[model samples]
Every structure is written in structure tokens, then in C-alpha cells.
Target: MNQNVRNHRFRKGIAGLGALATAAAGLFVGTAGATADTTEPVDPQLAVYVEVNSNDLANVADYTLAESGEAAIDMAMIFAANINYDGEKAYLHFNERVTETLENAQTQIRPVQAKGTKVLLSVLGNHQGAGFANFSSFEEADAFAAQLEDAVDTYGLDGIDFDDEWTEYGANGTPQPNAQSFGWLATALRDRLGPDKIISLYAIGPTYTTTDFSLFDAAGVLDYAWNPYYPTYDAPTVPGLDDRGRLGAAAIDLSNTSAATAADFAERTVADGYGVYVAYNLTATDQSAYLSGITEALKGESTVYRAAPGDTTPPTVTIKSGAKYTKGDAEDGYKRISFGLHDEGQIDRLYVNGVLKDLTDDRWSDLNFVKSGAFGAVKGENTLQVLDVAGNTTEVSFVLTK
Candidate 1:
């Protein structure tokens, strides 16, 4: 959830939004990639959230690890998609930009991920009666979890991050916040996503106070819990999460949080032995100094800004002839083709015959693939579609003869 919006609304007398504005957002405003200089030490656990509602998601990849350049943050979270109730039922709502980004994950999202960043979709509330911590039953939680799982799989995401806020309890006969609801939902998400996917929490709202910590299996079900309030240091009491799993330092809002304060937070996070540092709301402008404050304090390295303008061009896929058939036999008439995938961002998915045949977690930039066998091509006219992370695609049709 965006603290700026929450702070603005709360100042206008909207209660139940949880806490006052952060010191940074209330008083000030300010300004990804994992490109790091390997020569120096690195703190690869820094995390950030980008508000897709206002800023372009590509900005997250602009931060290089160091002077080496072209690196991405360890994790990049999409600010949010909401769980809103429609008077009949609660459903996931991805605003226009969020929907566009996810729908075209190959172009907008994959390129960032290609730079070695883990992309996560954050789920929050929309001032509706429904929320993560108000599921009426375990089954209800499971239903929501299924929606999240489908979204993660559909977009090829790394995981889901839960932020329980802006929910008007019992607004439309929806169940009120309960101790078990948050835990149930988290557990359900864990069950659906299996043991490998990340399930993190922004430690605020119902998740901050609820007694569901006992139910969280930090080693398995939960990855890390971050303090949501900015420029304030507070450690959440989630069970099973040790120093590595607890991010207690102040969470900085890049626009408002001062570089000194951000550096102090990073220093505290490092000195206190916390494994993760949190920063949010990165814009298109260069924020390398603010980032350098954190990186320097946390890992004794400087932050580098590569300064690439936003990408709007679509990716291209071209077929290459005269390729050796490495995997299949010519006797069976099953031959493979080689193709070049090029993009300003990164290539993410390939579809043949309207079916998804190949995908990657870390998207690619200018690559060649030679299918060993006749995976999608048949002995007739075949269609191929390639997509970039920003949802751009290049599709073509070619005839295959035996």
C-alpha cells in the first residue's frame, strides 16, 4: 500500500488506516537494477517497492550495484493490486497499468527480472470490506490464495507480498478482522505456492497487531516481514523469524526520506545484524546518492545509476535457417529451428500454435535458441510468438515442409 495516499487520507480524518504519516512522507518528498561492482562487498538483500500507479516499473532496473553497472536490486515489488469487494463478492483488481504490466510480463517485467531481480506482486486492500485478514473461513482464504497463485503463475512472478490495510471491517457484511484470518490466508498461500515461492509481509495494519504470528511457520510459510512505517525503527514480533528474517530498521520513502536518514537506517540495519533493508517509491529520476547511502552503509559499496530512459519499443523475433537438427531424427521428419530473440528490455516468453512452449524466470536480452526437437513446429504452417517483459511481442508464421 502507498503510504503517501494513506498519509494524505489519514490527515483528512480517515481513521483505521493504521498510524500517522512517516516522518519523511509527512514532512518531505524525494526521488534497480542489480548491477553491482563485484570488486567490492555487496549487500544483496536490499528490497524496494515501486508504485506502478505513478512511476514506471522500468525505473527499478536503473540502479546498478556499483560502478560495474547493469545490475538489479535483489527484490522489486509491484506496489499493489487490490482485493476489492463488488457488493456480491471480493475479487483481485489490477488497475490499468498493473494489468498491462502483468499481461505483458515479457517486456516490462522480465527485463528487470533478467537483471537478477526477484519480481513480486504485492496484494493490499481497496477501502472495501474485504481484506487479507478478514476471510470468513479457511476455504475463503484458500479461494483468495488460488487467485494469487494463478496470477503469480500467469505472469511468471517470483511470489506474493501481503499488505493488510485500507479495509473497512464489516463494511458490507464481510467478516471483520480476526486473529486467524491473516494466518489462514498466509498458510493458504503457502500451500498453494509450495515451499519455494516467497510469501512476505509488510508488517503493518492487521498483520502488525494480530495474534497470527503463532500460526506462521517462518522457515517454510513466511520469508521476511518488514516494518512498513518510514524513518521509524520497529521490529515486528513474528515467530520463527530470526534477525535474518526480521527487517526492523526504518523503511525509507525515497521521495521524502533524507539520504542521511536512509543511510542511518541502513547502518542500523547492518549494525543490528538485520538481514534486509527496505526502501520504497523509486521514481524515474536518478536516486543513486540516496541509494548509495544505503548501499555504502550496508555493504561498503557505492550505488551507480545507469540512466536509461523508459522503454516503449516492442521486442523482435527472427527465424534463422540452416540450423542443425540436434535433438530429433530426420527419419521421423521432426526438425528443429533456430531463432534470434532481441529486445531493448528482455525476452520472456515464446508461444507456438497459441500454446506457451517456453518461458524464463530471468528474461533474456538478445539471445538465440535452437530447439533440439520438434517441440512446437509441425509438418505444416506454424505460428510463433515472442514477447518481452513490458508486454510487447513479435509474432510470425512460417511453413514447414518435410
Candidate 2:
């Protein structure tokens, strides 16, 4: 996702859960005199992935340990670096601010790891051209994949969250969108890191309809598919995806809604049979309450996480614009995207990039087609998110090359 100024970009721009990955044997064993050793994290269901870039070592406590009491989710997907893959291999580099957090991994991540909360290192995509041009070929990824494995060992990380936000600018992080390569990487990771290690992915727009992720399921490598960047993407309904409902989950961006709204989403997400993942920015909100509210609302289901019901499924939507949003040059003209939504429940609201639409007529089409120009669609990525009265959500994200 291309970032705003206040938030520190992991690399000037960059880029969650499922089945219980077995913690690496002896991986949680503490080094000589480490403070938070032996804390082993449980299989996290209610999770949060936070960015460490904003703190600058300021009063803001590190995210995982910031909460006063027990954590709401069992895992914390922490940002360590922005990744880039050349034609052959993948590489990651951390922002100066994140570098500091990594330095404190022992103090920050270790304890969480020891406490049974999996502390994952989230690696995003590149800002450079072809974002993931490198490492697209599985053969070329041996070394690159090896490096990733080393990272897990060195940092004592549980596993990786491949946020391949392909098709979006700045945040587009796929390694050439090669499904085989992705599956191979996961396979390699399982072999190298341990089968019990968790492997999660981005249930982004393109990935939902494509077979790219099925390879992961065939390999039995995926733990869950976490949705965050896109506001309304429901979990994919793909067969053979063993962990789809168990580890596959959805997330709420705090910046997009209020605590009450977040709670509502979490409730619906939990009710939907899938787990819940929440993405938080350290610099943006009141971290304590944000963490606490979800924790409190999720009472009784902490240990045995809630599973989403078939009835709680979100709506289905499509952007008639086809693929990309912006047609051509900024002067070429705006594209009118005709879209529709369908859910078992009535829609409560519709939002595009965080702004509400005019739906006073009550007819679905009233908010259907959007002229990019009239709706303030930007030159890059644009999203159409629809949430129903029952809390089901569906969203579509497309690129506008203006």
C-alpha cells in the first residue's frame, strides 16, 4: 500500500493466521539471561499485525507488550522490513525505525514468542518497478528462500506473512504473482522451518478468483488468508483449502473505523466461521483501548477462538470496470465502474477509500457505478467496500494508471 506521510514507510512504501503451525522445537528456548524467555504463544485466533515505524523510540511502548494485561489475540504480526524480489530471489530491508525494533527483538518479540503468542515478521513488497520482479522463478529462490529461513531462525520468528498486494501501487508486493513460486516458497519454508510453522497469505482481490493460492492448499502449506488492505474482501470459498475457515481470517483497519465499528466487524468476523485479525498503527490510535475493546468484546472465546458461520458470509461484489480502474492518461478521461453487491442481509453502508457514498434511494444501483473523477478516485489504487446490515463485507480494489 502506498503510504501517507505521517506513517513511516518500511521502505518508502511496501506492503495474517490459520492452522496452528507447530512452534519450532527449542526455538522458544531463551539465550543466556534473556528476560522474556519461555513465554510460548498459543495458537492465535484474534490477532493484530502492527507497524513499528511511527514510534521513533518515543513514549509509545512497543506494540505487543504495550497492553497492561493479557493480550487479546495470540499473535502479533510485526513489521520488520519491506521486501523486493529480483528475477531470481527475494530480499528485505528494514526502515531505520523498524531496525530499532528488530534490535529489541529479544526484549519485544522473544517474550511474546515465549508467552505462546506467535510473533511473526511481516515482509511486504517492493516500491521499485515490477515490485516483485525478482524471485519469481522458484529455482532462483533457493538462496532467497534460504535467507528467509535464516531470518526466522536468527530473529526467532514463528513464520512469514506474504502480503503480496499485487496490482496495487506502492503496496503491490507479489513476487511476479507466480502461484507456483509462492507455493514452492511455502513448501520450502515448511521443509526448512518446520511443518508446524505457520504460513499465512493475503486474500487480496486478484488472489480470490485465481488458482494461485490453490497450490498452497495442495501443499498443505497455508494456515490462513488475512484480509486488511481491501476493506470488504470476504474469505475465499475455495475447496481443498483445509484451513480456510479455521485459520483463514479477516481484519479491520483502525484508521477506517471507530472502536464500536471495529467491535461490530470483529463480532461478525468471528461469527463467520473464520478467525479475526486486526491491523493497528502505533502512531495513529489509542493502542490500549483499541486492543482492550476487541479483547473485552471477544470475552469467553479467547482460548477457543470463534468460527464464522456460513450464514455470516459477507456480500459478493464486482467492479464492472473489469480490471484496472483508471483507463489511461489523466487527461484521457475517467472510467465509470459499474458494480453490484449481493448479501444474505441488507447492506448497511457503502464506502470507497474511507468515504461514504450517497445511498438514500435504497436501490442498490444508486451507489453502483462510480465515475472515477466524480468520486475522487485517485490515479493509483481505488477500493469499493460494501458492508451489509448483518456485517457481511465485500470489496474490490483496482489500479488506475493515470
Candidate 3:
């Protein structure tokens, strides 16, 4: 049971106790250091930040490396989350879509992780004065670090990526940006998250202007840092971080960036011995050709588009053979009713009596909810609704005789 779906159900009223039983089944793929069978990540990595607020995170798996047959993008970053101050303290806050993505990590995120592409959540500021550089105390930093570690552990994320922006330091009665706070927080995160877990920086804003070197192990704590601007070549000048840890050229916005410029960025990244190339805001539209410019320049191979265009047809719900209420065969209320849903387009939502009961990305031909008492069938009329990713919907209603 996805938490978002569960929340939806609660707002609409209780759907069933059956949903609670499936809650444990929604396990995250795994944490860092758990990639035992995955392909080793490529060098001179092509990392992309996916805007989950607007696009599907699963889009990260759509591009494949032409030569190695692995994920073309080495890292898939969740574009952002915020550190918000809620009067008393600062805490991590994920927007609705980010929460949905993480809650559905097994379906939305695991496919990319399965391809050996690391998935990281990028944390930034929300103008509430809760940025990374204004922690005020080491304990405050450690407390925030624990929240991040818990999120990683709970969601099976690869690690954290820091993007220092929009913090509005000195607002909301919070301390202004300090030199030691960022280093203290980063150090505490590295200490708690373990060595294999990734810790990256966006290499812009206060993370550069305010971070102090002697307070934190820059080389040891951060795994990668990339320039935040687009179509530019400027490596971050953080002390202790080397060239291989720095990705200094050709950050691009896929929706608007020029391919040739991206190619030049990749060319520079490789020629200058930078360890990573960065792209942002990948969408459902195919960008293999645009991405190939970077891949060909960096890896000497073309990028492959492996995603099939989504099906647009609506899904169907049918009363299966054993459904007594629909057939008018059982006068007494039936505890179990059988039904099947079919969709080549892939069913993404299942609603019962106007409440969301299940959500998934899996395509289905004939999925049945026959067991577990027909997913909490109650006396009187019941309605089942099904929908696909393309927003097509189908609904069926049946009445149990009193």
C-alpha cells in the first residue's frame, strides 16, 4: 500500500482493512552497498537530475548505453526536496510528488537502480531559513543528518545530494549562514551514512561561498560535485576535492539545451579528465538523439532509446465468474466477489467506492482481486474503478441483495 494511496483512501473514508495488510509489501529496493548484482557504474559518468515534480522518475531507465548495454546515465538524481523550518526546528520536507515517488520506490525508482544507475535525493532550502549552512549548532546538524539517514534507510536511496539554494539565511529567527555549519553537517552525514553511500554537492551558492575546509573532510566525505549552471565550464574550487570528484562542464537542461553545446560540454569533461557530465529535467519525450551528442563525445557511442510510447486506450473492469452479487445469484450478502481488470496500457490506479485502494506501474492483462475477501467487499452496492497512466478510466458497480 503506497502511503499516498493510503492517505487518499483516508480522505475519502476507509476502504478496507485489507489495504493495511499489504503495507509491509511496499519495501524499498535496497540501501547503498546493497548493489551486489548490479553493473558497476560507468566512469566519466553521465549523471542526470530528474524533475519528479513534473515527470516520472522511471524515465531514468529509458536511456541505455550503446556499448555496455547498461544505463546511459550513471546517476539519477531526484531534482529536489527542502529543509524547512517549522517554528521550533528545521526538518526535511518532500513535496507531494517526491513523497509519491519515494513511497512507490519499488515500482518508480527500482527499475533505474536495477540498471546500476544511482538514485539520489537532492536537498535544498525553502526560504524558511533552514539551509545547510545555518545549523547554529553541531547537535542541530547531527539531528538533521539523522533525518536524512532515516530517509535513506527507509526509502532505500543511494544517498544524499546537497544543493545549497533559496535558504534566505537569517530569516525566521534562524542564524545566518556560517562557515562551520555546512562542514559540520556534511561530516556528520558522512559519519552516519557509511562509506559506500553517496554524498554529493551541487557545487553552487552557499555550499561554495560559506563552506569551511578545515572543519570537514571534503575529499573523504563527498563522492561527487557538479556545476549547477547550464552550458558552462567551471569546476568547483572546494579544497580537498580533486578533479575526478569534480564534474565541471556542460550541465544541461534537456528541455531547452542545445545538443551541440551539450556535446562540447561532454567533450570538455572528457578532455579535462572530469569524472562526470550532468543533464537535468528529462521528460517523457525521447531525447536519445540529443543525449547521443554527449555520449558520443564522452563514450564514443550513441545513446539508445529503449522506451515504448505509452498506450492510450482505457482499461476495463469486468465481473469475473465467481462474482455472485453482479450475477444476482446470491441474495445474502457475499463476503467475496471476484473481478478482473485488463489494460494493455497498464493499470496505475484502483479505486473502490471512490477511495483509492491500490496503485502501481505494472502493466496488466487480467489482474484479479479475488482473494482476501475480494478486497473488503461490504453489503449493499460496491463500485470498482480502474485507470491507466494516460488517464483513461473504467468503473463497474454491483449490488448485494439484503
Candidate that scores best on TM-score: 1
Q: Distance (Å) between predicted and true CA of 72, model 1?
A: 4.9
Candidate order (lDDT): 3, 1, 2
- Candidate 3 lDDT, tens digit per residue, 1-402? 123211211221221222232234542111111112213333588888877777889988989877667678888888677788998789999888889999999888899999889999888777788889888899999999999999999999999999886778878898888889888898999999999999888875566666786677888888877766654555555566654534444477776678878888888767667777888778888899999998888778888999454456888776666544334434554345556677777778877666666666666535354333355445677777788877898877666543
Q: What ranges in model 1 sit over 4 Å off?
A: 1-44, 67-72, 307-402
| Per-candidate local distance difference test | 0.69, 0.52, 0.73
Looking at model 2, residue 151 earns an lDDT score of 76
Instruction: Go through the candidates in order and give the C-alpha RMSD of each one to the true structure.
Output: 16.1, 26.0, 19.6
Candidate 2 residue lDDT tens string, 80-128: 4666545333566667766677678766676666555776776665454
Give lDDT tens digits, candidate 1, residues 66-136. Answer: 74454536788887888989886678889887887788787778888888788999887777789887777
Segments of candidate 3 deviating more than 4 angstroms? 1-42, 307-402
Candidate 2, which segments miss by more than 4 Å at Cα? 1-44, 56-69, 85-89, 129-136, 166-176, 205-211, 216-219, 230-233, 237-239, 242-244, 247-249, 282-286, 301-402
Worst 10 residues of 1 by lDDT: 27-36
TM-score of each: 0.66, 0.55, 0.66
Clashes of each: 26, 27, 0
